[model samples]
Structure formats: C-alpha cells, structure tokens
Target: MANIRFHPNHDLLSHYACGELESASSIMISAHLDLCPHCRQKLASIEAEQASELEKSEPAALSPSLNAMMMEIMAQDCVDIPVLDEAPASQLALEDKAYPLPSILQRHNDKIGPWSRLPGNIKRAQVDVSGDSQMNFIYMDSDSALPEHTHQGQEITLVLAGEFYDENGTYQPGDFIVQTEKHKHLPRTRDGQDCLCLTLLNAPLHFTSGLATLLNPFSQLFFRR
Candidate 1:
C-alpha cells in the first residue's frame, strides 16, 4: 500500500536485477525499490527466474586437469584478507527535521554535500557519485515552482517526501518519474505541501520558457558537477 503511481518499466528493473544498468541509474532504481513493495516483488521474481535459467544453462563439469588445478589452488595456504567495515547509516537533515534515507544511499551520507539555495524556492544537495551523471536531493518549499524545463539527456526523479505536480500528473512519495528530451513541464508543490526528491540527471536542464530561458546558462552551474 505505498500508493505508488509510477514505477520503472520491467526492462529497466530486469536490467537493474541483472546488474546491467550503469552505476547512477542503478542507484536510482535501488532507492525506488526501497519505497516500492511492488517493484521489490517483481525484482524477486526476476531473480528467481535468472537463478533457474542459470541452473539450466550451467556447464556440465570441469575438465579433470582443470579440476585438479582448482583443487591444488584451494589446498594452497590461505592468505588473510582484510574485510572493510561497513559504514554507519546517517540521516538527511533539513530545517531541523531529519529524514531516513533509502538503505542504498545510507553509505553515501558522507558524499552528500551541504544544502545550497537555487533559483526559485528550491534547495539542492549534490551527491558525489563516481560517474559523468549528477545526483541531487532537491527540496521544494511549500507553494514553490520550478520554471518550465526539458532535459537534454535523461532524468530520473524519485519523490522521497511530500508531493509535486506537473503537466503529466501529481507525484506522491515513492513515485518514480523518468523524463527525457521529449518532455517539458513546470513542476510545483501546493500550499503547505513541500516536496523532497532524489534526482539523477545525465545532462543539465534546458529552461524552456520566457524569463526562465535566461537561466539556461546558469542551469549548468546548478546541475553539472
């Protein structure tokens, strides 16, 4: 009963479960999975199918010489391998309120930069991911609105708290929205309804209207790492 109205397609979920998606996209999908039980169940079914297929396609047996070599390798003296300790989970705090992050993002607490104000009534915190893509936590204050914009590449937004609406539809918590160059809309929150979202953008946003188009040059400063 998450009331989730949006989700990644089956192909995307399959790619995620098979470890075929890039790091940034995988992180977005993982975070979405944290909030969506439906996707979790679908992922489990995909994994089971993959396991069954693996079993069916498994090679028959190792060659005798290869088995002997493997045995010898296993019989060799064991070297001490140091295992790194897991990082402690951390909360995302804003305006004196702390929010629990998705499990996949827990370790990245240290990577999250301090919040910074953006144009409009929005605030953003960049997440240090190791890739060309950029990830951010975008918080919109109550009754705030972002200028109409489109994407140059692709963008994925996951609503973590509150709600936001655009030409497409209203998105509640646990909603997974994907937009590309073909989409354009103005996103906003209603009175008393602020919103927080985790977003992954492969390219800077393209401001598509009136005075907001003047912000195109500055868009790189906000979105590009």
Candidate 2:
C-alpha cells in the first residue's frame, strides 16, 4: 500500500465527479483515486452532494401511474444477473522489473506507446489520451536525476510506484503533484530506490541551469508525441 501524502485539489475532484475534466487529466485523477482511499471518500461525498442538489433542482412528484409502475417493478422477483469475469490486472514491464498498472490504465492498455529513452536515465512511454495535453509514464532508474527545470505550462504527476524527491520534498506512491511555470526543481531518486510515475504536461518543460540549458531542444522529444 502507498503512504499517500499529496492529492488533487478539491476543485479538480469536483470537476472529475461531474465528468468535466479532459480525457488525459481524467485518467490521471482516476488512477490516483485507485491508490487513494481518502480521495475515494471525498469523491463519494461530492457525488452524494451532487445527487442532493439534483433532487433539489427538480422537485417534482412522480405521477400516480409512474409510481405504480415502479412499485410493480420493485415487487417482481429478482433475477440473477450474469457477472462478467474481470480482466487480469495489467503490468508494465521495464527490464527485470514489472509494475501493476492502475485499474483505469488497464482499460486503455492498447493506447500506451513503446517506452523510449530520455536524457538523464529516464524512460518515457506516451499514453495516447485525447485533448491537447500529453500523458506519459516516466521511469527513473536508481540514483538517477533529471536536470532542474520549470514548467512551461502545468505539469501534473502521480507517483505510481516507489518514490522520488525534489528540492521541495519526497513523493511516494499516490502523490498527486502539480507544478506550474512558477515552480522549478530537480527530481531524482535515492541510491537504492527507483520510481515510476504517470505524468501529464500541458506544455514542454523548460530546462534551466548549467549545461542542462542545452537540453532545451530535447524538450520536444517529450512534447511531440
């Protein structure tokens, strides 16, 4: 089980409950919800609240004929509903290591692209979700580091397995972290520990500091498909 620390903001959760987020963002949140019991409870609360509001909006009494039909249906004997077998959980393989995909990703497994090497011991596999944003699975090898950078737009990352740390703090599984243009930091893994994360970026990353600045061109590798 993950020791979840970060979570999507309440506004995001509200939008998710209402089915308002874009496809890529929705998948990110759904994956986080799978790993987070807190968010699950919050979502249930939001759903219940929405249901109540819907009742308030249409405060109409059911007609006698409709009420009778409902009563008759309720009185009918219950029939056994066939239960479909659940698909086996999907696994993402990286050499000798395999990580179980979240439930949401399993449904869209075919959309995941091949993993490609990235600079600084990172590997990325694009997820072909709809909308303008880009989604990818990022794997960081042990003791690996990505150069310091700031977001060109918004970047949302959810730790799927293991952990990584930045100047701000350590992120464990189920951490839903968001960084905007104003935030800048270097992300790396510790000596023995590695990390697997699902990340969504609205724009390419802007490399900052040292020789890494030359890597600005490399950002396109992550941005364009």
Candidate 3:
C-alpha cells in the first residue's frame, strides 16, 4: 500500500487534487504521479473517501427559484481577472524552457501559480507552494548532486522528472523518497535532464555538507525563517 512517507504531504496532495493548490504545485504533483504509482493510489483512496463522505452527507435540494437566482448571480459575476503582466510573461517562458539533460532527455516546468524563481546552479529554480510554510518545491539541474542535508520534521521528495540515485534506490520520475527526522541522505542524479521535484519541507533543512557545517551550527537558516 502507498503509505504516508516523508512528510505527511497528504494535505498538500488533497489541496492539489481539489484544485486548491497553485498551478505550479498542481503541475509538479501531476508530473510526480506520472512516475510514482504508490502516491497515486493513496490520492485515489483519499478522493474516494471524500466522494463517499460528500455523497452521504450532502445538503438537501434547493428550491427552483434558489437555483435560478444562483444561476443569475453566476452569469452576472462572469469576469476575467488580470493574469500575465510583463514580468509574468517572461516567467512563463522560463518555466516552459525544456532543458535537455543527456541522451535525448528532456524536461520542462509548466504550471500556473504564483511561482518565484530561486537562485542556484544553471537550470535550477524553486517554486513556492504554501504561504504557511508547510510545503515547498525545489527544482534541480540534471545530473547535479544536491547537498547533503538533514530535516527536523519528516522530509518527502517526489521526483517529477529525470532520475536520481541514493541509499534507497534509483528514483525516476514519480518515485517518492520518504525520510524520517533522524535520516540523512545524499542524492546524486544521473546524466539526463535535470529532475524536477516537489518537496514538502515541513521543517528546516540542516546543512551537513562539507566542512562548513562542522564549523557553523547555524549555517542553514530556512528552518529558522
């Protein structure tokens, strides 16, 4: 069975499935499900349970006049809010850039959300998912090795594109790696397109890479944020 591994990102999954997540988050998860069957099954189960509950406890019928009034209101409320400004147009193009990794490998980021690019190596960026700091999205350069880091809470990493090898196994697109609070892993991606992933970073990531972390305990600061 698809158990809740990594962070309990089920709420984020639920939000994405129910059309509550931003476009970027939804697209990233959709790509992940294309790879990992276990998470897909879990999401299916949750959806089924929610559907059953709604069917069992839905509200009673509304009057015909009430329906008519609702319809009228909807018709009157039809309006197109602003979407792409000049800055967002460039941002959109950036997401659509399909960087080639190796051996004909290709990956692209296409999601509609309030996404802000983060600084990193070439072809790497991060998307913001939650305002409440529950979920996070991190993008990687193909074949790049992420720095070894530890987490305070559970850490869930779902591969959206490309492949990476770690202590567990070779995680391709859609495969999820669950990490506990006490676990530490170093992941190295194989040659190909860079892997895109959605990370439910519930806690701060403690940097354990190189000699820097040994010298400074507070070098990593996102958790403190």
Candidate 4:
C-alpha cells in the first residue's frame, strides 16, 4: 500500500473520471494517480459506480433533426481516423537529469517551456494547457524555500519527486494538496533533499511575509505566459 497522505476528494475524483474537471485540475489528478495506487483503486470504484448508474438510466429519444443528421453522417463514407500513439520516448529534463513524466503529460511534453530560475533556489517550467489556469513544474533545490504565500483563488500541488514540508506537514510523492486564500505557508526542502512538484494555480500567489511581500508584484511572472 502506498503511503499517500493526501488525495483528491471523492467529488473531485468523480469529476475527473467523468471528464468534468477543468484541464489544469485534471492534469494534477492524473499526475497524482500515477503515483497513488489507492487513488487508482478509488477511481476504478467510482467509474464502476458511474457505469452502474448509467446502465440503470433510461435512454432519451433523439430529436428528429438530430436523428436525421446522425443518419446522414453514418451513411457517408466511413473514414478511419488515425490514432496517435500516446506513449512517447521523451523525458522532462532538469539540468542534466531526465525524469519520466506521467502518461497524461507525455502528449504535452512539447508544450513545456524552458526552465527559469526563481528568487529562491527554485526552478520553474510552465506547461501550456488551453485554459485560464496556469500549470508549472516547480523544482526546489536542497535547503531551499519558497516565500511564504497564499493563493488568491485556488492552488493544487502534487509532489512528483522527493519531499517538502510546510507548516501543515511533510508531503511525499503522490501527495495532492489543495490550497485557497484561506491557507498560508512556506514550502521548503531540507539539506540533501531536493523536491519537484507539479502545480496548478488559478490565480497569482499573494505573498504575505515581510520581505516576501515585495515579491507580490512579481507573482504574476510565475503564472503569466
């Protein structure tokens, strides 16, 4: 059993299985599922429940126009759409090291931007997903710390490698943490332990500490394209 301390709630998992979650949130959930067997089993259960419910529901009658359009489309030449292989021989690189990405993100490997250094001993690479939200791969070097901050809207962070600690507790790989304006904390790694995380932010972070407050103006740089 994987010791995953954090996980997406049942509602979020249901939404993810049903394809109802936003793109950014869906990516986070997918990454977490890659590392969490518990969540994988939970998701399978949810999917089975959904299938049972769908089986019990009565089918609705299609409109005459919709039925005619569907018939016309079906009568036309059957075109075989080529299916692209989802597995790619690619890796997410940090410095000289390369890490295998989650299966869901493999297709978007090209959309990841080059890494840029941050004020702290952190490096960030943005993922270009079609949505209002922002997704990033945040790499924290050993003994590094992010400025104390809170989210303006919502922030989801999933540990990809190593471990990090905030005032709340320590987070290992597969931990799915959600934060909003109501939560504030500083994330850091100890000596000899580096950390990498996939983060999705709906809004810019609000730095609240003394010197870190000065970084509020530059917070947009973290999320902006």
Candidate 1 weakest lDDT stretch, 10 residues: 54-63
- In order, the Cα lDDT scores of the candidates are 0.90, 0.91, 0.56, 0.88
**Top candidate, metric lDDT:** 2
C-alpha lDDT of candidate 4 relative to the true structure = 0.88
The segments of candidate 2 whose C-alpha lies over 4 angstroms from its true place after superposition are 60-81, 217-222
The sequence of per-residue lDDT tens digits that candidate 3 reaches over residues 1-225 is: 133233226887888668887554465466566545677788999899888887666334657888687667756956898976432212222366542221111223232234454323334334434443344445666666766766766666776556667776676655656677788877776667566655655566665777535533553454433
Per-model TM-score versus the true fold: 0.86, 0.89, 0.53, 0.86
Residue pairs with backbone overlap in model 3: 23-112, 35-174, 36-174, 101-192, 142-194
**Candidate 2 Cα RMSD (Å):** 3.0
**lDDT measured at residue 185 in model 4 versus the true structure, 0 to 100:** 96
For model 4, how does the per-residue alpha-carbon lDDT over 1-225 read when each residue is reduced to its tens digit?
Answer: 276899999999999999998888888898888889999999999999999897566234667888688668767997899997666646889887788787888877989999998868999999998888999999999999998888899999999889999999999988999999999999999999999899998999998886879878887885678
What does candidate 1's lDDT look like per residue over 1-225, in tens digits?
Answer: 368999999999999989999898999999999899999999999999999997676434878888688778867999999999876667899987788887898976888999998777999999999888999999999999988899989989999999999988999999999999999999999999999999999999899887889888887786667
Question: Comparing candidate 2 with candidate 4, which one achieves the higher lDDT?
Answer: 2
Residue 202 lDDT (model 1): 92
Error of 2 at 121 (Å): 0.8
